[model samples]
Target chain A: MKLTILGCHSATPRINTHPTSQVLEIRNHIFLIDCGEGTQVQLRKNKVKFNRIKHIFISHLHGDHCFGLVGLISTFRLLTREADLHIYAPKGLKEVITMQMKLSDSWTNYKLIFHELTSRESELIFEDDKVEVYTIPLDHRIYTNGFLFKEKENERKLLLGNAEEAKINKAYFRKLKQGFDVINEEGELIKNDTVTKAGSAPKSYAFCSDTAYNESIVPIISNVDVLYHESTFLEKLSHLADKTKHATAKQAATIAKKANVKKLVLGHFSTRYDNITEFINEASEVFENVEVAEAGKTFEF
Target chain B: MKLTILGCHSATPRINTHPTSQVLEIRNHIFLIDCGEGTQVQLRKNKVKFNRIKHIFISHLHGDHCFGLVGLISTFRLLTREADLHIYAPKGLKEVITMQMKLSDSWTNYKLIFHELTSRESELIFEDDKVEVYTIPLDHRIYTNGFLFKEKENERKLLLGNAEEAKINKAYFRKLKQGFDVINEEGELIKNDTVTKAGSAPKSYAFCSDTAYNESIVPIISNVDVLYHESTFLEKLSHLADKTKHATAKQAATIAKKANVKKLVLGHFSTRYDNITEFINEASEVFENVEVAEAGKTFEF
Candidate 1:
């Protein structure tokens, strides 16, 4: 899986910094998360094919998070896209986007599907053959949700030489890979483990942002391979973070530590600090494995 | 008068090319026109002070023209702006902005006033002590209007040497500057022309964009000091311009010549063209003084 940070700053977009937006690629699916303003341009700059973005997930209705939805939808129409697009966001976003389209008289030629989220409890939101996505209800001023993407366990890898040595016929090879005992040509039962080995471990990632330091999400995102949490403020301005319903670096690190994530990525900086290295200094004090997110940075796992 | 092109391309913003947005400074007031996506970042890159922009004029409801408005307004609130902001746009825009703010619960601390426009003919929209703004109705796929900014006639310069020779008292200086005959110390009426020349001719600017080749606006923008017109295509693609309700470079120059504008600026070029100099070449064939608008380029009139 690969993740690209298109923007990580908070509040407002600056000349050199952008607001909240990221691209996650897993199992041939590219998901766009929280499309802030100028996100389409950022996508172009990062060399991500616009047509690959089939699903868009928005955390909330704040302008910094979802303001670019209308523009991206409009650009897709201008490019004459025919693929169906799905949006997973809060309930009010569909109304806002529909009103904008009606006023501009710019109806998309393709299908636009909106899966509005209103539930306050964690629930499965997206599922396919290879991956599953669930919503992690977050504590914020407005209705918000973080997404958890998990890859399904793969089939066992079959050893051809071992299966042949066991006198297994070609017709029973499929059953052996499925971790099933099968009868060979000589009417002898063969154990699946003798001819097969376990596949590589699956990967999981969790995205959380615009939320306060709440332990409720720690259980939901426990033991994920990678966790991206919002660190809008440092320890110096922890009070501001509390008042704004945002998380400080220390708070994010605490959540990461409690969740036991393999690696923690800190983002959504407030843009008030001159040096972002301070975030690493503060977060690493609480969590050993921590990294700060920057615009255009990529992480592969 | 100073004009800065924040974005000059059409359709959608790309890695380096932006959509439609510009800043016009006349008489001590800064007006933002056609705020496309990424306009706030463009403003920051151009070093435009945010507080100076008290009024924003939107040309239409197209995404490329007004998508950045909500983000800009939200940023103003985040910055704790205290000045009142006035927006003049089509009637539906107020509803859209209101709904966005309501959903986000980010009400501005400062007053946000909206002037909903639904007129089909030319009309005065804004007026202050030194500047007057009028809307020029245009033909497009949707409801659209261009703006005309006119500087009010300035006070005549008081010629100290000429006034002293005429034996005029300081008490009558204001009246003389107002172009009235003033009584001298010797009780003789001094003619206004002898002591004071006419103030520099009031500068005028007209902004027309996302419009087709329509001559009706010629009368509204006739003889302006500067005219910024949309040229989305060259002569080769003139048919596309007509079909899309846009204008070609030649067509823009034709209107500029017919209206006797002193300077014509062609902008909103289509991304299909690699060289923008072709716009200047095509427009200069019909108009003597023509320049193509580039992102971040400034023009002084």
Candidate 2:
């Protein structure tokens, strides 16, 4: 799996920086998370195929997070896209989007679907054969959610020489890969453990932003391979962080350390600081594996 | 008056091209017309100061035209701007913007006034000492409006050497500039033409986009200094233009010639045709002084 950060700033998109938006690639499918304004331009710059984005997950109705959504939908129509698009966002998204389309009198030629999230509790929002996405109900001033993308465990790898010697049938190959013993045509019991080795470990990525430093998320994203948390402020302005319901670099690092995440990627920085290396140094004090998120940077895991 | 083409391409923002957005400077106040999705970036690339944008007029709620508005407003707040920004847009804009702010809880520190347009008829939206902005109802799929930015009648210039020789009092300076001969302490009649020359000739600019070839706007912007109307298609694809409620190069030239505009600027070209010199060449068949709107190019009148 690979993660690409289209924009990582908070509050707004600026001349040099962008708002909250990211792309997660897993199982040969690209999923867009939190499309901020100017995302289409960023997508073009990053060389991400526009037509491949099939699913979009918006954390909330925040302008910085979902403002690019309506434009992207309308652009799809102008591009004459015919693929069905599915959106998973908060409850009011349908009303906001449909109203703009109604006012513009331009409807999409493609099939558009909206899956609204009304539950305050954590729920599974998206799932497929190789990945699953669950909402992490976050504590914020408004209704919000954080998405957690986790890769499903792969089937065990078959040992080539042992499977061939055991005369394993192609139909029973699936059972062997699932770590189950199978009887061969010679009436011999083929031990699954002898014929197959365990597959590589799966990875998980969690995205959290525009939320207070709530410890509740630690349990939800426990042991994730990579954790991208919002660090909107520094320790010097921790007071402003609380007032705005945002997290500082130190708070984000503490959560990453406590959650036992393998690596921590920090973003959604406020436009105050001229240099962002301070955030990296400060977060490194708490969590050793801390990196600052930059626009147009792609992180592969 | 000066008109700058920030972006003029239709649909999405392209590499060298942009969506629909323009800057018309009238009476020294920069007015941004129809902000597309990448307007903030385009504005930065063009080196236009964000603070110089006093008013923004959105023609419709189409994603390509007005999607970048919210981001620009949010960026102004992030810059800690104290200026009062005004927006003239469709009726549902307030609801869409306010709801996004409510959801993110990121309120603007500066004053934001939205003058929503609900009427189908023409209305004067903004007026200052030297300029007036009026809406021109257009034929589009949506409830859209075309804007006419006209320079108001300027005050007469105070002829420098002549005024000094005429012994004009400082208190009567205002009256003298208004082309009224002031009565001196000893009653003396002075010819107004001798003391004052003509001020700068008033120049007007009209912006029409995403509209069909309708002659209704001819009366509103008759004899305009410059008319930048969307010519989405050439005469070869005029049928497609009619189907999409867009105009062709020939149609725009016909409007310009009939309205007696000094110079006609054709823009918002469809992405299909790469060579756009044909648009200008074709429009020049019916009207002289026809130019194609190129990005980052400025025209001073």
Candidate 3:
């Protein structure tokens, strides 16, 4: 799985810094996450293919999180994109985007679908044969959800020499790969473990942002391969974070440590600070594997 | 009057070229015109003071023309702007913007006033003591208006030397500047034109965009100092212009020549043609003085 940070700063877009937006490529899906203002330009700057973005996941309806969505939709129409697009966001987003389209009298030639999310509990929002996505309910000033993308386990590998030694026919090879014992041509039952080994472990990634320090999400995101969380402030500004319902670097690190995630990526830094090294330094105090999410940087897991 | 082209390309924004947006400074007022997406970043790149803008004029409701408005409004709130903001746009813009604010639960601390325009004829939209703004109705796919900004005769520059030579009292100098003939202390009337000449010829600027080649606007924008007109295509694609309700470079030059404007500024070129020198060459063939609107380029009249 690969994740690209198109933008990570919080609140407002500035000359060199942008608001929250990212692109995640996993299992043949290029998913856009949290399209803030100027996201389309950021996507162009990052060299991400616009046509590859079929599914968009918005964490909330804040301007900095979802303002670029309507523009992206309109640009798609101008570009003559014909693929169906899906948006999974808060319930109010459908009304906002549809209203803009209606006012402009411009609608996409493609099938624009909206999956309005309102459930406050962890539920499967998207799934396919290769991947599954679930919502991680978050605490914020408004209703929000963090998405958890998990890759499904692959089929067990086949041991050619062991299968041939067992005299297993070609038809029985499929059952062996499925971890099932099958009768050979001689009517003798074969054990599945003797012929095939287990597949690689499934990997998962969790995205959390614009939320206060909440431990309830730990169980849902436990043991994920990577966790990207918002660290809007440093420990020195924890009081401001409390008031704004945002997370401090230390608070995000605490959540990562509690969830036992393999790696922690901190993002959504407030624009007030000229330097962000302190975020990593503060997060490292709680979790050893921590990295700051830099704009245009890509992470592979 | 100073005009800054923040962005002038047509259709959607790209890596280097942006959609339609500009800043016009007239009579101590900074007016934002047609704020497309990424305009705030463009303003920052151009080093424009965000707080100085008090009014915004949107020609139409197309995404490329006005998508950046809500983001700018939200940014103003984030920056804690306290001054009132006025937006002059088509009838449906208020509902669209207000609904987005309502959905995000983020309203501006500053008063956001909307002046919805629905008239089909040319009408005065804004006026102050030193400046007057009137809408020039244009033919487009949707309801659209071009703005004509005229400096109100500049208070007829006070010819101190002439006034003193005429033995005009200091208190009566105001009357002379107001173009009023005054009675001298000797009980003789002095003509106003004898002391003062016309102030700078009363410079006027007209902005016409996203419209087809229509001759009706000639009378409204006649004899203006500068005319900024949209030339979405070259003469080679004049057929496309007719079909899309846009103007060609040659057609824009025709309008400039017929209107008898001093300078013609052609902009909103389609991204298809990489080299824009042809647009200037084609326009200058009909109009003597022509300039192409470029991003980050400023024009003074």
Q: Is candidate 2 or candidate 3 better by TM-score?
A: 3
Cα lDDT of model 3 by residue, B132-248, tens digit:
899998999889999998888767777788878888888888888889999877778999988877677678999999899999999999999999999999988889999989999
Model 1 clash pairs?
Answer: none
lDDT of 2 by residue, A230-299 (tens): 9999999999999878999999999999999999999999987779999999999999999999988888
Candidate 3 segments whose C-alpha is farther than 4 A from its true place? A170-173, A184-187, B183-191
Q: Tell me model 2's lDDT, rounded to 2 decimals.
A: 0.88
For candidate 2 chain A, the 10 contiguous residues with the lowest summed lDDT are A10-19
* Candidate achieving higher lDDT, 2 or 3: 3
List the lowest-lDDT window of 10 residues for candidate 3 chain B: B194-203
Report lDDT per candidate: 0.94, 0.88, 0.92
lDDT of 3 by residue, A1-301 (tens): 9999999999888878989999999989999999999899999999999999999999998989998889999989988999999999999889888888887889889999999999999999999999999999999989999999999987799999999998999998888888899998899999999899998888899999989999999999999999999999998999999998999999999999999999999999999988898999999999999999988999999
Rank by TM-score, descending? 1, 3, 2
Q: What is the lDDT ranking, best to worst?
A: 1, 3, 2
Which 10 consecutive positions of candidate 1 chain A have the poorest summed lDDT? A170-179
List DockQ for all candidates: 0.93, 0.63, 0.79
Better of 1 and 3 by lDDT: 1
True contacts kept of 2: 0.66
Q: In model 1, which regions exceed 4 Å deviation?
A: none
